[model samples]
Target: MKPLSIITLDQISDALDSIDLLGEMRSAFIAYSSGRSVIPPVGELIIDEQPPGEVHIKYGYVRGGAHYVVKIASGFPRNQELGLPPGNGMMILFDVSNGSISSILLDEGQLTDVRTAAAGALASSVLGVPGARVGIIGTGVQARLQAVHHASALDRDDLMVWGRNLGKCSLLASDLEAHGLKVEIAESAEELAERCRTIVTCTASHTPLLTRPMIQPGTHVTAVGSDTPDKQELDPRILGSADLVVVDSLSQGLVRGEVARSIDAGTITPGRVVELGQILDGSNPGRSDPNHCTVADLTGVAVQDLFIAEAVARSLV
Candidate 1:
């Protein structure tokens, strides 16, 4: 036993700097879509706010050639009541040769947060119009990651933020401005949606935060909030109108996604759905034109967990 190496979030960031983590993530996803990999089912246990249910766990494995990653994430909102962070997680990488544990990365949810944003950025880079002003719904952890990740990907400098809390949005706007980028806090989601063609949502809302009327032609929206069956962040109409709809994992989304519910309701269909991996591998079209409306429904994936694990393992300690 190597005593289960512990890699912290700060160390993970340093590791990312020394390698092309984003490129690795992109390649992993593309390989997944190309049918060269297998991602097992994600098991989730939800905690209702009413009773504040038990802590939930989601674990999975992604096998890509001689490498494999085992990922586990646990969330307990009630941990906040106990004065602790609500979410915590770690990943274990296996060499696949002799069944030896290669590395254990304690990402502290940073891998999930960052990889989710990076995937969104990759989707935006492939689907969004160049130099598009970005719109963000919710100014939480995921929102901050999205802002930085997408900015890095698309060379976007203008950001528009909208949250239910004006003060928080204003704070986020000021923070981005301090980074030498232009930021605006919108009064409403509709206002933000109307201004920017590229929208990313990362709120913990169960209801729809964005509506069809708010969207404009050529807009690219990535819904990263709905990882469970009961969680939703965008209007069903948005899915109905999107010219190109891509998902991180079709099986995961169809079982636990807002878009999946719409597909089940006949508002959207499986035929209209595309996988990001397919698009990345050139097996499917990404963006046909600059004016096409695109939507990437991200429920997260096991492959991403593996991707981040590889990134952390190769990082200099």
Candidate 2:
């Protein structure tokens, strides 16, 4: 067995910042959805269900690659109560030929955060309205990165953030402000959806935080949370109202995301939900009208982690 190269969080952040992540993510999605990559069903384990935190074990290899990746990402809402970050985990790379471990990315789940935000930006790039204001629900790492990556990728400056905690929301806004990214704090998720043109719900709630009536017509929503069956951020009715709904992958979305909940309730059919790759591959037009509501549920596909983790590993070696 070879000694595994451990890539630290600092290295992970630097490597991620040094690449065209959103572009890479787009390519990975295209490959995954186009049958060019291998992504099996995700394995999950709930560590704490109270505030709803769980660990996901994802593994896959892109065809024609020398290495594959297996990532274990965990999120615990009580971590903050323990004075630690709510997310922690790592990704391991293996040489496909002999199944030997190649490297370990101890990113502390920063890679997931980056990839998730990159997916948000990708969805916005394809479906977001021009000069539209972006809104983020939740005051966690995802909320901050959504504003950062979405603003950069979509080239939209106006942004707002909403959360159940005013202090956290204000702090997030202030941090973004210090970086020249102006953001306002919304009183609630409902207010954020009504006031902002585009919204991304990044909460860890087991219940729906953003409902149907709170959303206005022509809104673009990227639901980044709810990767587990027990966790949902957007109300299923919102999925029923969307003119077009996209997912990182159809298979994953049908089982765990808001799409799953919507499907189970018969609010929307499986055929109604499409993969974002189809939009990128020119097979499906994502959102044709700027005034039509669109929704994209991202349940954190393995291809994303595979692509980015491999990229980070390559940069190091």
Candidate 2's clash total is 0
Model 1, range 1-317, lDDT digits (tens) per residue? 34346677788878877766569779868877876666767766556676364332344444435457776676665676787765677777776656677677887666777788888888888778888899989877788878888887878788889998787688888887887778888888988888998999988788899888888998999888788887788888888988898998888878877778677667798878999988888889788888888898888887787777776776654
- Our model 2 lands, by Cα RMSD against the true structure, at 1.8
RMSD of each: 2.4, 1.8
lDDT of 1 at 64: 36
> Using TM-score as the measure, which candidate wins?
2
How much RMSD separates candidate 1 from the native structure?
2.4
Q: Model 2, range 1-317, lDDT digits (tens) per residue?
A: 77779889888888876788988899889988889788899998875557777788999988888778899998887889979998889999999888998889999988999999999888877887777789999888998998899889878777889888889889999989987887888877878888887888888888899888998878999999788777788888989989998999898888888999999888899999899999999999788887899999999888899889888888877
> Positional deviation of 122 in candidate 1, in angstroms?
0.8
